[model samples]
Target: MSQIKGSSADQPTNAPLGALHDIRVLDLTQALAGPFCTSLLGDQGAQIIKVEPARGDMIRYAGPFAKDAKTHDFGNVFQNANRNKRSLVLDLKSAEGQEVLLRLVAQADVLVENFSSGVMERLGLDYERLSAINPKLVYTSIRGFGDKVGGESPYGHWPAFDIVAQAMGGLMSITGKNENSNVRVGSGVGDTVPGLYAAFGTMAALLEAKSSGRGQYVDVAMVDAVLAVSEVVVNTYDATGVSPQPMGNELRGFAPFNTVAVKDGEVALGAPHNPQWSKLCTIMGREELITDPRFDSDLKRWNNKTEVYEIVEAWTSQYTRAELTEILGGKVPLGPVLNAEAIFADPHFAARQMLCEVENPRTGRPARITGPAVKLGRTPASIRHRAPLLGEHSREVLLEAGLSDAEINRLVEVGATTINEEQVLIKESAVR
Candidate 1:
């Protein structure tokens, strides 16, 4: 490997004191799943050093950019996943870059990536090699099938995306209106769910390593994650020897536990329990159903769901979602299907702080984004900063890593690195 160089100045101070504050993460992943995994870590106060190629993470060019961004770093997807991490542009193809990575690995507490199984081995930076430099390093890999760290799957060598994971893992099998037309989930849970699992797995490995004075490879397959999440299908199939089919928005084994149409829109309604079902019958002015043999018990109602659904829908469809909400919101377990606008305007979201504002470099104004889901009374998760510009912290990060200014300049001069701090611009008047 070639000689390395870089310099660092004073680091920022606005970061929150999170649970993982002492941890250092070298993020070698890109795209949704891997980036999201690192982002979760970043949220919990890990010092995430995102290693990018000279051109930057490919997701940076994804569009739907902010209006004021002439040179857009990324759009909604990238922004959502890459926040609270510093960027370091290093071309791994170069020998110097590989050496630089190895040096970083020596000091990092955790290193995470989502490349295919053999990419790390090809780069000569696999867990075995990196752990040799730092025995306590918690190295995690998130992939479609999985790496050989635990045990290799039959499809370990195959490439996969969120849709592929969803399909192969059986999520799509029970996602649509019927079995004939299986649908992919709208969100990228197939990717991010695996990311979440990897985050937990990484933390667990880190904890064990602390006690044992040894690090272990933590691997999570996207397919496996989805399969774990959709275990109902597997359990149902295994118990009865019948493959599960999509029941649309309804619980196949529970009556009235489904999305019902209203005059204006749809609302999810679930009154499967006896008390709730009895109340629902009274509310619908169909109290006779309380004694009807076909609808008396939960099992009978489920068995005769077609008749029960028709009766419920007939009453629900007569009212608008708002009117239905007024009548049944507290009495029955129901919620209107909310769109983005509705969510933004909802008091519940505001009260919970589910949506939060951050300073946007493009407009130099506040931009609203989703807030962290987990809230710790102490050491709360927070968004310290927006996503970084390409190579935005390359020099600074290298400096913090103890490289001299001269070496930093040489790396930039040799076309091996680049830095741009001006990419993040906030107006002086804007509040943090």
Candidate 2:
């Protein structure tokens, strides 16, 4: 309902681009999941006003900051998750801070938070109150378990992290070397996947709000997101009335649908179809196995997959990862398991623009980060700048929001903002 007024940033080169460039979001999130959600939106060119506490986000101080960074706030974890966002540090526990947040909410198209259940209500900034100010605001929440506004699961009060999501969401049960051992996913997919869902859900709600002239709550639960990704496990259990256990790296019904050993490392290869299987057999110089009774059909080969893997590995084991790639890269579904160093070195990543470079704002040192995954030919998503320092854009953001210099100064004096007179003057041009 409010007009977009200011978008000038400290660095003129880092102009926002993409379809969502005109949209504004108030990011009241911290740590991984919530920040990840907003970061995705920011990557697509949303103006993300990241509202942090006076002390700043937990991640800002919880570093391993960038090498020789003037500010300890430039934590690599924070940098990786918070690119393209502008920071505003405010004391939201105070009345003045609440008033400021409400003002921003009135102008923002969306507001996202990931605090546990009842935290918003306790802070007196719940959706019911904020929506009354801006009926078109798309308020979204990311939580471990959903709240009353959603399905009202009894476990809403439970403290959860990535491990809880993996365990409770059935991911761990179906992911290990054996039935007796369950392993959490290697990364924080539990947080990231749910955050991704939240970002999508927010987009859906925003699209609907455009036509309906009203917004609704987008509730995304981490556990639910994990379960959604483990679709195969659910489908198998539902279809056969049998729970699938961790069957190692092999696919239960598909022969040669797993990684095989190479001389230096492992490469995942799949040849579960007849044509591909025949090609693989020929390549291995074991042409007779293609029509042998035990390995005649894909299903028969699956029934004897232990032998299938042995035969495949026997051929693969002699070659290094690079050698196997040269021999079998195009013939079958193949992926070489890569480490960080390999990813950085791989030409494929560079060609695809998957590895992006940006400068650390405090240090002016160039750093590489993963780039925006969604490629748009017309209006591409750009990494305009690195993540902000704590309260880096507070004065500029408020000025852009139409607050006068005097009013901003008063708030700073009242301890509601972490801005000084010098900081207030530093980015005044950002509003111009």
Candidate 3:
């Protein structure tokens, strides 16, 4: 533990709303999934103390760096995932650091980690050990696979990245154009989906802990979480002996639920069931086509999906996406295929506050970032603080741990901690 500097007289204020104001969280996770989960909790006023190894979280090196090109300065990916939290650099392998972690566990309401199966136990900080220190501490573990019961596979020990999980969890099977061309999802759905489940599980455990006056362990496996989202494909294979293939822009069980080419761009429309198909035909001035034996029912239209989509495209290609949207939008379900620029400029996104501007301390400019997906009316999510510089709050966090100034100086002198002096110097130089 390090000590406090600057104004030791001024105490740090709590989070604005303080929804989870008193709830202390020890975040021992890294990379995308687990960080994202804790970030969400931090947004709602959880006192998240991010315990980073001496080398820092791997995301610090994952780039989109500032003009100065400092590797450890907040990279875009790192900033996006880790906001509204305090960070402490500690070498968990060291006895002193492990003792500090144990102290934190004793005072914490939750301990979240995404280490491999046995790392916690190897550290002698597993649920069994920590529960003795604080019986009400919720221990949440995120892993690549479930270690309980017969669910543990031989690959449990092997490390996994987002791409590996996507491939192994069946997301790639139905994500591309055809059987030969399988595509992994563009985003880290495999990693993030599991994180989402883990966060939910942690919250549930907290609620339970309140009632039972005991803490429980939460196990969230990326493979299982990704597989849960891939249930449609699983059910399709189970119900019918046929495995679903990648069908680019086409809905698996519904007809006319695909993309159509317009004169200017493309639009997606969904005739979810039979009645919507009839409504679509009527709106297109093709009432006769609705009565045709080949397109009368949902099954019939599905059987002749190619021809049905071709007919729709013929009509669509004569008009721009905007024109078609005006003519048929919300009548039978329709939306234009908006690109990134268009999405940023969209009125709906603006109205919903889906995009927002946060001040970037490094750039000294407003950086546009995505707003919170989950909207709560009472306690709305916000970006109160900019992403921190490397070890920005080292002194403040150590002060919270009740360290003295001389002790912090000794730790820094001994090479156990660091600060972004270079970044501060750069900023000062720029101002001059």
- The full ranking of all candidates by TM-score, starting with the best, is 1, 2, 3
Q: Write the per-residue lDDT of candidate 1 for residues 1-432, one digit (tens) a residue.
A: 111111111124654579999999999998889999999998888999999988788788877688877667667678778877888998787777888888898889999998888988898888889999999999999999998876879999999999999999999999999888899999999899999999999999999988999988998999999999998688999999998999898775788899988998789999997899999999888888899988888899899998888989988999998999999989989999988999999998887777766555556555676777888888988777777767878987898877899988888887778877564333223324
On residues 25-67, what C-alpha lDDT tens digit does candidate 3 reach at each position?
A: 9988898888888877876767788888777888877877666
- In angstroms, give how far residue 273 of model 3 lies from its true place: 1.4
Model 2, residue 264: C-alpha shift (Å): 2.2
User: What are the clashing pairs of model 2?
Assistant: none
Q: Mark the regions of model 2 whose C-alpha exceeds 4 Å error after superposition.
A: 1-16, 67-71, 420-432
Please report, in order, the local distance difference test score of every candidate based on alpha carbons: 0.84, 0.85, 0.77
Alpha-carbon deviation at 363 in model 1, angstroms: 3.5
lDDT of 1: 0.84
lDDT of 3 at 228: 87
In candidate 3 the C-alpha lDDT for residue 282 amounts to: 86
How many clashing pairs per prediction, in order?
Answer: 4, 0, 1
